[model samples]
Target chain A: MRQPIAQGRTQKLDSKRHASAQEILDAAATAFSERGYAATSIDDVADVLGCTKGRIYHYFRTKGDLFIGIHLQALEWALEAVGPTAERADLGPEEKLREMVHRHAMHLMNRASYMGPAQYQIEMNLASEGRNKDEQMARILKMRRQFEAYYATVVEEGIAAGAFRGTDANILVKAVLGTINWMHVWFRPGGPQDSTVERERTAAELAEFAVRGVVA
Target chain B: MRQPIAQGRTQKLDSKRHASAQEILDAAATAFSERGYAATSIDDVADVLGCTKGRIYHYFRTKGDLFIGIHLQALEWALEAVGPTAERADLGPEEKLREMVHRHAMHLMNRASYMGPAQYQIEMNLASEGRNKDEQMARILKMRRQFEAYYATVVEEGIAAGAFRGTDANILVKAVLGTINWMHVWFRPGGPQDSTVERERTAAELAEFAVRGVVA
Candidate 1:
């Protein structure tokens, strides 16, 4: 966040403000999750951060912008979690899927805040329009398709290798991804029944279920 | 829609109007799925039905009531689909779970309109307040629990009979149900690549995967 000393204090302040975009996004994600995206506003996000709306606007132009940022971050996390497994040449399709599902389950379970808004991006897309809606939706979709394609590719490989039952790779991908994505909606941390370790065990079991679904 | 002749023509008209409640709910479900619950209104639902707002108002007291009614109806459909499988004494737990999941996936996929809104009841619950919110949410939660409890019972029975793997039954139930509930978001009928038979096969495969997850 440091600007060249010769440039002046004003530029340093601006850079510092820019660096706080993540903080704004984290606050916005929480607000959107607690209060549905349509009901939440810049004021609400600002209120949560103990800042003015202008502070939010410094980073995001609109509520849609914040939502898109949250989604992009979430997609990045999901891709980051599974991309390595998908790309590894040493792993077969079955192992690839197992690792991908395991990483994704952990990501979704651990980052519960971002998953809700990211999963509900369809509704968020509907709530905004004419303000880069086409570009934003297209980009989000591209990222989502990339994420889903990883699963589809692995499923196809599994089928070819005779490790998985032959089925429509696309639909099979959805079924497996759905189980992973739905983690945040139900799995709560520190519940009497759901200790931290129990959540980890459940994540492993979920991966097993998803992998087993396609595996012969 | 019949009324006694002695009650006159007015009574017949009232009965005819009363019978249209299901039509209103159906239209509302479609509108809600398309425009989302918060964006949809009585006028939107009526417009879809090619009727006036008065027609919708006569049947539903508010949009919340209509949303709740749609949720209840969807829940009823889901329960109806899986209830018989749960009750069958002839089938073992593994078979019961397989049949129940197969029936549920088909129900969710076939009733895509209702399932979208029903699965999104969390957002709907957030949108409305003070208008039977407690009663409606409680009833919805109760129905959902009953639905989940059915899965839990079968998982327990499966484990007891040494037919399935030992795991956290509650967590296993959530994982399976999440996959089933997520069907509507992605699966559609008669896509260029997806046929009716293909959809059925995917449903069966999902059941196979879910049942295999728990089975020893």
Candidate 2:
């Protein structure tokens, strides 16, 4: 009876399930960030969420799974942030790269507390235990490369058009990424003197600088 | 007889001790970066060094201490690379920053494998245990600031001299740092197609791009 009733509202139920999973990933990211990954346990993640371990287990099969989930979500967020700008046909290469980098900087700061999960993620994927885990890790690396490749392609376009300086697209993209990614080291949103306006301003300046680096 | 003999060889022994400490740090940094810090055991570090855990213990009191040692060394490397340029009174801000960033990129590439310990450190300092540990961590944080401040001061000078764009000195410094420090992510020296000439050329280009982002 309960199964059929739940199945009746499949769309709403699926959305609710998505929300629950997001909540767990956020809690786990915070815990893993505060305590080093090795020191953090699934029980601690449950404690933060004020739920039972079984509840978390229902969503994630293991701690490693939760770690991978957080990384995948970050990649998803990265794609979501850059996809529109990357796809917009009207935008020039410079404008596309600027908007893409600007959005990326903001996204990074929004998840600043999870800088570890966001920035330090790719390296730790192989150390975890689970089946098909290697494939998942490979996907994470693939998405990362693809994320970088978006910037590279735009940069290549800029270089070919003589809008960007003549440099390797790969190196330029890494430098731009380095410039924006460094924000996680200092630009915490709730930190001292941080405000929404301030974050926007910082992101703008970062994008400007990143673009300036590439422009002819 | 032993005490007098040891006293006679003090300076030579001290330099040898320094070399041994450096060897251990390099080995430990490699192990920590390859295996996540949580997954790396001190024994693994010994395995890399081809020595016993006792020898490692003779230098570092614990794994966290070894972690701190690597970070401190990285900071030391950063300072060593930038200090001469930062202090040279003859060079203006433009030259100073260019040379400084160029040197920094090379230094980062040299230790590219320690990107985890170099870039992902400071956050984990608070999670460790020991007497005066907080003081040591604070010093690490302090040295890190002092390093960034080197660039900040230079940028401030450039701003004052009408040489740099009118931006927050702190933000400019961070952007520059992000540009060079990012080499560790993808610029391994011994990796495929890597060469000393290529490293120097990349550093020069990176410095040029970083400085372009700052010039008025």
Candidate 3:
């Protein structure tokens, strides 16, 4: 009975540690997004986490490492949210595109803090005097290419299915993705309209425009 | 003779001061582009200018002010570069679009430092901070709307003249502009081909695509 109790306590401690790390990441994302990477400090993140800088150091070796980890995790979340919809073989290409747009926009609107930081770091911070700069950049570029390729595949399939035009798939993909990414820079959570309803409308309009451009 | 001499001296001093400010702005543009607004400091700008922080402060009030100035100046240059071509009444809509694309691409590629910072700041930083934030945003949105309105007008004219199909002009304008702005994010100067040549090809392709999409 004592052995079991000891094991349960260890499990609880592990869970607590995991939760702490997550809190730190959340805090870091907000700081990085608002103040930018260079201006934000470990202490700032720790303050938000209600912890000490040493706690952050225990989990993240360096600020650069933390930022890169944040970037990858954000991307992973985005992919998980949209990737499965894209992979549904039973859905038609148009439907897949629509679902992808809806999910992508919804994720961005709801998770703006997480998504916004990833964008700021990638667009503004990664190349600046960061640790493992080259490796980090390569990883980012690779992930971007993978994401683009995924979009291109969808466009290509749509074209083959007589739903999209035989236009250059690469350019079309870029246009669609660029419009979506640009949303992070401007999208607000709550203005006058419901965010979910507005996002759905925006996504639907964008998808329709894209389909029109690519469809024969 | 003394008056002329004094006037010349004053003129020379003013020119020298202007030259220094231009130099500092140029250096700051590069640093901001490579390091971003947050990671970069007045000292970094001064370092790039091969001067002291006092030199930077001599021309601009703060880093934020300097960044906003650079961003506005870059937009001014872009407007000057593409604005005339867009205003030409002799060219048809297709030709005008082609010219706008070529000039815009050339400007971005050649002035990547200034243009990149402006693009990044407009899309990300402005929304995140103070410093005439609302006014700057309104101005930017106005400029964008004007640009899109220009495209929409052309599309409307083309449709009226029976030169194009009846597509939603606003949506088409947004798609094209989104594609063009997206270039600033990913376009590199050169690889196996000259950047000028690539710009022309891209411009031509986009023009053709837009024309094909709308043309009757």
Q: Pick the TM-score winner.
A: 2
Q: Could you give candidate 3's per-residue lDDT for residues A18-127 as a string of tens digits? A: 67667777888887766666667799888888888888888777787777777776777788778888788998887787777667767777777778777645756665
Q: Where is model 1 chain A poorest over a 10-residue stretch in terms of lDDT?
A: A1-10
Per-residue lDDT of candidate 2, residues B1-216 (tens digit): 112111122245567766787788889889877766777788888999899998877766667777777777777778898887899999999999999999988888777655556676557544545555776678777988888888998999999999999887778888998887766656655778789888888898899889999999
lDDT of 1 at A84: 83
Please, what are the lDDT tens digits per residue for candidate 1 over residues A137-200?
7777898999988898889988988988876676678779888877767765455665667667
lDDT of 3 by residue, B1-216 (tens): 112111121245567766777788889988887777777878888888788998777676656667766766676677777788878899887677667766776677778788777764555455556655566566666765665566777777777776655555654565556556666676656645656666677666555544554555
* Model 1 per-residue lDDT tens digits across residues B87-114: 8899998889999999998888788889
lDDT of 2 by residue, A1-216 (tens): 113111122345567777887788889888876776677778999999999898888877667777777777787788888877888889888898899999998889887656555676446545644456777778878988888878888999999999999877778888898998877666756788788888888888999899999999
- CAPRI class of candidate 2: medium
- Model 3 chain B weakest 10-residue run by lDDT: B1-10
Model 2: per-residue Cα lDDT at residue A137: 73
The CA lDDT at A13 in model 3 is 54
Q: How does model 1 do on interface RMSD, in angstroms? A: 2.3
Give Cα-based local distance difference scores for all models: 0.77, 0.78, 0.68
Model 2, stretches more than 4 Å misplaced? A1-15, A128-131, B1-16, B114-116, B128-131
Under CAPRI classification, how is model 3 graded? Answer: acceptable
The TM-score of the first chain in every model comes to: 0.86, 0.86, 0.81
CA-based DockQ, model 1:
0.45
